[model samples]
Target: MPDAVMPREAAAALKGDAALPQKCLDCGQRIGWVELFFSLFLGLFKLTIGIISNSHALIASSLYSAQDFFSSIIVIISMKYQKRPPTEDYPYGFGKIEYVAAGALCLAVFLGAITLLIAATRVIFAGVTHPAHWVAFWAALVAFGANVMLYRYSECAGHRLGSPAILTTSEHVKGDAVSSILVAVAVLGTKAGIHHLDPLIAILEVAHIIFMLYHMLKQSVGGLMDAALPEEEQEQIRTLVTAVDGVEQITDLKTRAYGQSNEICVEIELDPSLALAATAPIRNAVKDTLLKGLVKPSTVKIYLAPAGEGRALASSRQQAVREALARYYLGHVKRHHLEITPSSVALRLTFYSQVLPGMRKQICAAVGTNIENNIEDGTVSVSEV
Candidate 1:
């Protein structure tokens, strides 16, 4: 029931105004409700039929369906947490805690597969017999119809929500559908006096369960690991970061996925002339660009650095101190530059702004304060640019 919208579609769906948190909660709730109904139906029908047929496979399938129903209830409870405001203990928000639900579901499937296989093997070796249970046959047919209907609905909902949990549940339904078919055939075979077929089909159904479990496990693990964004997303992100205005070079770009969303971090080297005051706006612009066109995460971090000059020239005497300061502060006003000029004078030179050029004494006093506090003295002479 999670509405699986692509990044673009999700934005569009929220057009003109922000989408309500309630919308997301409702989607999760609706999906859970549908699954709950189907699960109950499957569980009750299978248990009834299983009892009448004395079929171990039918009984095991019923128990598994019951588990699925209960697990979905857990997911429903977790859905409310998904909407809870972040607290001190849970920082990254509760959105990703859904993955914990997925991991649990994976464990459930794994255990169910193991249990079913073990039970089937025991029944087969124990020479258990299945009766010609007409009631069980009809019940299975009804359950199969329900499975088909639930599978169709869940599949569509899963794709729309882009929820791995819903998708996994859909797949489980599909497996159950297949097993239902095998159950029908085996039941008929038993009724026809071909006694061995029921256990054989049960064993075959175990394979389907195993396949479903593996698929779910892969998805659950991938989310928990914070795996890197897909290749296409990475390429798009690189392009977006490099295209930002004033960015000289980008290094240490990294991205990771949290469920369907992504988080990105990058270190940028820019002209030192850029003002420090400009850092906030530029970082915001980059984040917006990525969110609009490339990757949108709960957060993005941008690290700023100098382009090329100041630090490398620190040991070289010939470099103009004024030019170094100019280049260093080009992109931002808050960043300072220290430069050394004219070799062998053993004197210091400094470059700074004289905001109140008329008050020579105040300017000189301010320059001294700026240097002593912001930079180490004796490295460069201070001068008005």
Candidate 2:
């Protein structure tokens, strides 16, 4: 009963972007390795400087770098999850977990910001602050440069992959770039006689981080909750589906996003006179049309029903019943006989080759359900001949 999620925004983004040739499932692997080493370098460099100078600002920057370090690890883990093929146990594939990863990254950013805010506040009110050493200045500069490079790399790759985890964490990494810039300013400002500038910049960066995290959560939570495709895209899909030959009208359409693509269920109404064989190809055409430029992998289901105003031609009893059977199976015919009696009906289905015993019960149950729906009162029997 759960709804489906579609990554619509990324699909839209992909429209104007023609340069990124590598948005495959394995996109984050290289990004992870890149961020991993850089974050480790940045975190260690800043932590060392912070320890030597006893500066909370540098120490907190070190923690921010450490957060990036962990995010890279999470990215690698989530990438593995993203690459998992759909199995019998997981028919929908493992793409939705990327949104979960994005959520986790968002939470980490929020917690880091809050922690930074609390620490900065204490330092602001705790009277005179210890002066940061010259080594702290070089550390801030190095962190700033490294963060800028990481931000650019993450942003481009995330957009290409349509991955919220990559995008959100990249933005978080961008915040670190901003943080280091402010840290550099704070150090220089304190040296230039504005002693309060250090903590003030920290406060500003905290506010910015909170604002960014709020937006990331707002966007990501919807996807995690099986958000639908946007109205415009829905209309676009509607137009495409109905344009296919033999689709008289579209009665209903539903979409759910899983990873980068959409899972769609379309209800198509056709003239009742249309043969089941005719409907099958129409369904396939509609699927191909909708998926041509779609960004994500999709599973599409087509439901066919008679058009509301269409009427069937009158036929003899035997012909009508056989026609119904043919329509249900889309004219994939074998030797079949329908036996009717008051309060009971039986169908003998003769297959051309071996009938798998496992499928025999399923076929019978399906035909039984169909009979119950149509005739209203017969217990149907299914026998494979």
Candidate 3:
């Protein structure tokens, strides 16, 4: 028989840390300010140049900058909701808001792509009458420099904080960098009398937007459905749990991400011979081990089951015991545990029996002799599974 296990919530909260959320908030703010500053600066700069120099490629890139600038505001706003503690009305917290913000950014990218492509197609057919002025080249160069800086900072903070929004925004900024380079090339091409290449650069910008939008859409949908963590991370979690002493085997394990962090649930099998008091420390140790390896969970559930007969390897030995005993009319045996010591063995169990109080002694004698084979010193308590 296995001892009663500790409550999973108490065990998971043994560390009592929710560092991931706050970390994400700080990362978002740092990256958000960068997003806003550069977008506003470059959007106006390129838009003004595109109109003055008659550069369609620069015009397309300006629309993208405007989209990025507004999406950064969304990212900053979403962080406010994500920073709140779990409330009674919302047990899992507001991690999904970041995902919503991500989706919105992707939508913004898609819309900008459409707008850019439409303007590019019109420019492609219209034919360039004159090359862009030298000022357009300098504008693209400056925009590329700004995007490169934003991408580095955002990529660093995104990976460190494990924020999908920051990472997505970084990709957006990278697209801007590439767009700026293409605009620079298009201006040079047009100056050299190849007017068609200008719209080609704008078409390339749309391709980048489509690629990023696909990724953002997939992740946002998966996050809402409580998708599992990556395969590598899941394997790491499994290895940590298996390393704990006295843990016979993992019966079940599950992990899912909410806002910025993840939640884990684990059920393990333990030796039947261990007493209830002995199992408590092992439970705490396992929880602590998990805490070290994984994020603080929004809801973690852990259960312990005995290893042997009723649960472990019942296929060959206990299969016959369960079927024959039920026919012999003892009861439906929920679980049976046997502990062996030098020269003696003990049996402890729980089951449901309909036998009257008057027939209890007869049933006990029959249970000991027929099923357990030596239930002399121990007792069988009636219960439900």
Which RMSD values do the candidates have, in order?
10.6, 8.2, 8.8
lDDT of 3 by residue, 1-385 (tens): 3333222222232235556445544666677787888788889999899889878788878866876786677667766677776675786678788677777777876887787788778777887666677788999999999889888988877765556677777877888888899899999998888888877877777776677678878988899888998898878877987899999989887878765567777777777666555766777777777665563343445666667753543232234334435644445444555433222233444454554544555544454555344233333332222
Q: For model 3, which pairs clash? A: 1-337, 95-259
Error of 1 at 261 (Å): 4.2
Superposition-based RMSD of candidate 2 using all C-alpha atoms, in angstroms: 8.2
lDDT measured at residue 243 in model 3 versus the true structure, 0 to 100:
95
TM-scores for all candidates: the values are: 0.67, 0.71, 0.71
After superposing candidate 3 on the true structure, give the runs of residues whose Cα lies further than 4 Å from its correct spot: 1-28, 295-300, 310-385
**Lowest-sum lDDT 10-residue window in model 2:** 1-10
lDDT of 2 at 98: 58
**Preferred candidate (lDDT higher): 2 or 3:** 3
In order of lDDT, best first, we have 3, 2, 1
